[model samples]
Target chain A: MPKIVNHEERKRKVAEACWRVIQKKGIEQATVREIAKEAKMSVGSMRHYFSSQKDLFIFSMQLVMDHVHERIKKLPLSGPPIKDAMQVLSQVLPIDAERRLEMEVWFLFTSKALNDPDLKKKSDEMDDELYQACRLIIEHLTVAADWKQETERLYALVDGLAVHAIMRPGRLHPDLLLSVLENHLKVIGQNV
Target chain B: MPKIVNHEERKRKVAEACWRVIQKKGIEQATVREIAKEAKMSVGSMRHYFSSQKDLFIFSMQLVMDHVHERIKKLPLSGPPIKDAMQVLSQVLPIDAERRLEMEVWFLFTSKALNDPDLKKKSDEMDDELYQACRLIIEHLTVAADWKQETERLYALVDGLAVHAIMRPGRLHPDLLLSVLENHLKVIGQNV
Candidate 1:
């Protein structure tokens, strides 16, 4: 019998290697040769997994979003709308090592997307997804007046905290992240 | 007489070129050769201004920070603390084309700084400066309780709005930005 390869698993492995390269060096250095070396695969084989660097980058960034979505889907939303919303939002934050890597990689891609139109589309889609999530949480919380403004506020606060946490994890600890978020929710709840 | 060249002026011109290259292409493309071409200078002469690309980048990034600082310093803060604070914060947002370029370049450098230790120090200093500014505004606002939390909240909100505005200027308009910010301040005022 001949050995068989899991194509999807191999692609995922390569994408993870790309993430490590992006984190260790800046995204600019995430070249195919470098990623191939990082992935412990021959460059020719790497091409088999991803036709081009752009394709690889798109897949890698999409993986980060998929991971967040997966985590959010798995969250045990045992009620009290604010707490459950917090649980959902926490899925996107860099609260743990795993999520931290995802957030960092996600942000690196976002920065790259500024000039790369293909990546820009992906970045915009993710932003819209996050915005919709915020809107959903606001609706669930029953924020009565100016809910649109409230949704924007909540979205900005979440992203700002995520950026700060990723940039300076020591200063913006998980406890403080939860505290800031909880306070915002409480204020919104009171507004209802 | 030998040519009277303004050393500082030439360097400023080169830095401005660097900023344009960064904004147009990504930061990785802001190489000495590319920046020299953009600035309409020879590679040999570019060396006289910045010994290395790293030196040029450092100077360029610092210029962005200095520009923001200069703008804030010149802001005519004819009071009503909340409005004054908004004016100070607005200087950092991408409200105009000039500021939008500054912000875009600033963010690109920030992402690069994650993997570059030398740039990391500069990025940290700017974050601390912004944090302190937020604290000052919070103090001026005289929020009696949890002022620290409030400061962090405000800082995150401003940065979050900035990142969003930079990413999707079409969606997050200047009007919406001010409205969201004004609403946050109103809520904080109510808390006090």
Candidate 2:
């Protein structure tokens, strides 16, 4: 009998390898050949999974998004709106090792997305999702006169904190990240 | 007699060409050979200005830092702390075409700096400068109980606004940028 292979499992493994290559080297080094070597698979077999480097990148990025969505979905929300919102927002921030790696790869892909149309579409979709998420949190928790601006502010703050945390992990600790978010929520909890 | 050439002027020209290349193509395409071609100079001559691609990248990124510093130094304060602070902060944000290009290049270099020690040092210096700038603005403007947290909050917000403006210029307009910053300053003006 022929050997059975799980296509989705193999593709995910390849995408994870691609993420490692990006983290160790840089996105420029994340070519199909390099990823295949990293994944311990032949380049030809790699092509079996992803037809082109662009497709691989798109898959790798989409995987990161999927992981984030999965985590958010699995989060156990408490009673308080502020506490629950903080828990939800923390899903996207680089608060832990796994999320940190995701944010780093996401940052690199976001930069590449600027020049690649296909990657840009994926990047924009993620941005819209985050924006909508922030809007939901704001709409649920705040009675601000201009909730639109509040939503934008919250969205920017989350992204900004994630970038800073990725860059200076020592300085922006997890406690600090939570504090800033909590403070922000309190300030925007009601019309100031 | 031999013709005299301005070294600094020529180097600045090369760096600007490098910026154009980075902006047009991705940073991966900003190789020394490609940069020389973009600058209309021979690769051999390019070595005289920049010893290596790393040096070129450092010089190019430093030039951006210098530009921001020069603009901030030249900004005329309007006496009010909030207004003056907004103007100062706006220099770093992608509020205009020139700044937008600078930020796009900065964002690419920042991502590249992750696995690069030399570039990471330069990136850290810029982060420190921005952090200190935020602290100064907070010190001059607010008496928050925990000024450090407030500083971090403002710093993250400024950077978040910048990244958003770069990614979605159409959605995050200049007026909206100012409004968000202004609102943030006002919120952080007095102790909560």
Model 2 lDDT tens row, B1-192? 646999999999999999999999989889888999999999999999899889999999999999999999999986789989998998888999899889989999999998899999999999999999999999988777787888889999999999999899888898898899898898777656
Task: Please write out the lDDT profile of model 1 over residues A108-172, one tens digit for every residue.
Answer: 99999999999999999999999999999898786487778888899999999999998988888
Question: TM-scores for chain A, candidates in order?
Answer: 0.95, 0.95
Query: Which pairs of residues clash in candidate 1, taking residues 3 or more apart in a chain or in different chains?
Result: none
Which one is best on DockQ? 2
What DockQ was computed for model 1? 0.76
Return the lDDT, model 2, position A104.
Answer: 89
In order of listing, the candidates' clash counts read: 0, 0
Error of 1 at B60 (Å): 0.6
| Candidate lDDT (C-alpha), each | 0.90, 0.90
